[model samples]
Target chain A: MLDMPFIRIIEGLNHTLENVIAPEVESTLAKGQLFAVVEILKQISGRFDHKHELIVEDIQVSQQMLTTLIETFTAAAIDIPDEFQANTETIDATAMSGEQLRQQRDRLEIIVSAALDLLNSHRAEIVDAQKVEHTVFMQLGKNLFRNMLLVSQHRFDKISQLDKED
Target chain B: MALADNSRLASYLAEKLGGSELSISKEWQNTEGWSMETFSLDVEYTKGGNKIEQAIILRRQPVSGLLEPYDVSIEYRILSALQASKVIVPETFWYEADPAVLERPFYVMEKVPGDVHFVTQNSDPDYRLIADDDERASLAEDFIDNLVHIHQSDWKSLGLDFLGDPGPGKNSALQQIDYWSDVIERAGVRAKPLVTLAVNWLRTNAPETDQVRLVHGDYRTGNFIYQHSHITSILDWEMTHLGDPHEDLVYVLGALWRSPAPTDWVCHLLSEEDFLSKYEQRSGISVDRDKLNYFQLLLDLKAVGIMATAANAFAQNKTEDLKPAAFGSILDLAYAALAQHLNERLSSC
Candidate 1:
């Protein structure tokens, strides 16, 4: 078991761009939009009350952004492993064609974007805390925190090995 | 003082203790490494079965060093002078500049204990969390206030005027920029494009120089030690030199110190604006925003160049710590930031 103390969040925002009625086709261009979204989240909000909200929002939005990014990445015609999916054997035996993969990537991009907007809407209501579902932020922050821990641990392992060897 | 095993230092200290029979106890010191490497030392001397215990630091020069090499006498003299000028510092105990004693110049000073925040872009959860917003703001304000006091300090009669004369050229800021740029160019392989661009921009837009002030070369969050909500000591001063009055300000507001943002004040508890205001009120010298921006960019450049130089040395196997491959990654990450900062500054200019 481990404990890493978190710092105070100074500025937090729920910056969202809604394009549900008008979808973005160029997922490659959408990647740039995701970067802006991350930048906006990087702002540190108040440390005492809304910080937990921001932390949770950061994780959900980050994951949602990554999901969109991966879709666009694959839409640009990337070969991905079936293991990335749940129950890979259960998926259709019909191998996805290049065009089909691109479409899947594009459509999945919309789903991810929706997920991000969902988080944004949840965050938007925070000016008045009574409006937001109490359990929502906690659930999202917890999930995102878990994923971040995994990624950080992976990088740290590589760093330790490199440090020891060099 | 606690000794890192395999250090041939204890016997060396005992043999040099003159006629007094000596017993040594050691403790760890986690601070400055410029003038002298410090370690806590407790010595007991017995003459005719009567013993007296004394506590001090074992200060020695590093054989293969990282920072600029300094003369031992300068530190001894400066601190001795500051003690008289009302600057809080450890009382100097002993100084041995002869290499024959410890194979390097060394000195011992009084040891003070306190909590240190180096701000590694990481958090420490142990201390009571500042559960309130207003308290964090107050802490940030105090930290900046200290810097104001430091800048407002009188070194006129302090005898610290003996350190270094301002280099050639009446404009100290340009002179400093030229000097650091030259150092960067000579210290690396191919010039880093971003740093090179920043250097050129600084040369083009020189800030009007002010009266020379004592610049603590490495004044950042990590340098100060604190205890019970009070700053105990400002640790590193090896890079202390006479130069631009804005040098210290830029360092405090530099990208490294602004790791999280200029807002998340560490060690001290105030926003960047709060700190600057405190400085203005105390020192009566309005901090020029233009010069501050230029110097802030310079600070980012200087930091990257210094880090690059270290990584390069480690890569070439010229340094003791052999982790260049790992440390190089840090330089690479910072390089992007340096590039962005350079572009932003240039475009603004």
Candidate 2:
């Protein structure tokens, strides 16, 4: 957190981000955040078409371990748990000044734009490959994101009501 | 070759200019990807009583990267070789394979202009939309036509065979699998479940490709340049090797393509019929659904391996490295969903 360049991948972390985004460009950035969250689950459910089409061999291992090294894997964390510790500290969660936030968002925009380019290309690739129903999966991703926004809005709205009472 | 005020790199570029009075301007870390730092430099000088201004790209390998050797010399060789063969690539100016000057091998290349991204952040309509269906059909044909030119090109003839990694006994896929599996295994606790399953699948049902073809390992969107609906150049040949052409094909048109209309594939620009028709005409090969489907899975496997490896490096703290990190880490997640989809489609087998 102390580092000047410790940027988080706010979005564009996976193809799911691409799917969640493609149709909703006209939507508010607030809604974009919701779709971003739901995309994680949808991506989990998607698989590679040719799962076992390559081969790996190593004499040192003596056996085809066919396993991902545990140390390198990161478990997905999505519950938005009541409290959870970050691997590294998030010292300043407080909002930044408008200019600072815009700069951050501007950098993020570039990263996100690259992702959209990739997604557009990927959309073509999937369609060409005939991996899935084009509209079904991609639109499913978009619709799922829309629902995600609805759910997130509900949660925030309840919080707002409680705040008014306080 | 040298960026503004970075004395370390300035000295190195000075060596490449062959004693020319090299002054550097506009040097800044690209801060782009998670694999390597890309620096842009403006080299100004007089070559023959005429002033010359050249914009170049310098990629310095970080402490750790997803690709090995990270040799700019190799890239220079590969690009130069491809240029000779009618493939579009950034022109290589100078390369230093030696690790002395910059404490790492680095290369400088002339920067090619034009937008490489097909989609803008604004979701600017795909450039393919510039043409009507018939014209779009031709563009799609031109796209695959380039690919056929690539696969049919003689690797030995082009001098790129030596630029890649090959195993002692096994073919390219096995070598790649072995390499990536090792990466995953070395990742130890960080290995995702999907990768393990994908590896097993890759091991059991390998594609039966015998003849070797040059594979532009990451031949997909975000790796090519286009101008006015023309495919300008193919970029990011970092994972080049000898493998099955289907590997490149499936990768080029993998799940990367999604459509507003379910049937309108071809990355939402060209239709599948149009793209494949062009490929068949250019490549002179017939496709079998089963085999094609298998290669589709291989594309995902390769992509996921890359992401997993990148995430591992980032975890290890090579932050300056630019490439996708945790890029498709959810690929573990995607593979699971896509597996069920693939299995259903392959049920006849």
Return the TM-score for each candidate structure. 0.59, 0.60
Q: TM-score of each model's B chain?
A: 0.80, 0.81
What is every candidate's C-alpha DockQ against the true complex, given to 2 decimals?
0.01, 0.03
lDDT of 1 at B214: 64
Clashes of each: 20, 51
lDDT at position B31, candidate 2: 41
lDDT of 2: 0.51
- Residue runs of model 1 more than 4 Å from their true location after superposition: A1-166, B1-19, B27-36, B46-52, B69-77, B122-142, B167-170, B258-263, B266-268, B323-329
**lDDT score of residue B287 within candidate 2:** 57
Across residues A16-70, which tens digit of lDDT does each residue of candidate 2 receive? 2455334445667856675766565456533312111111111111111111111
Q: How many clashes does the backbone of model 1 have?
A: 20
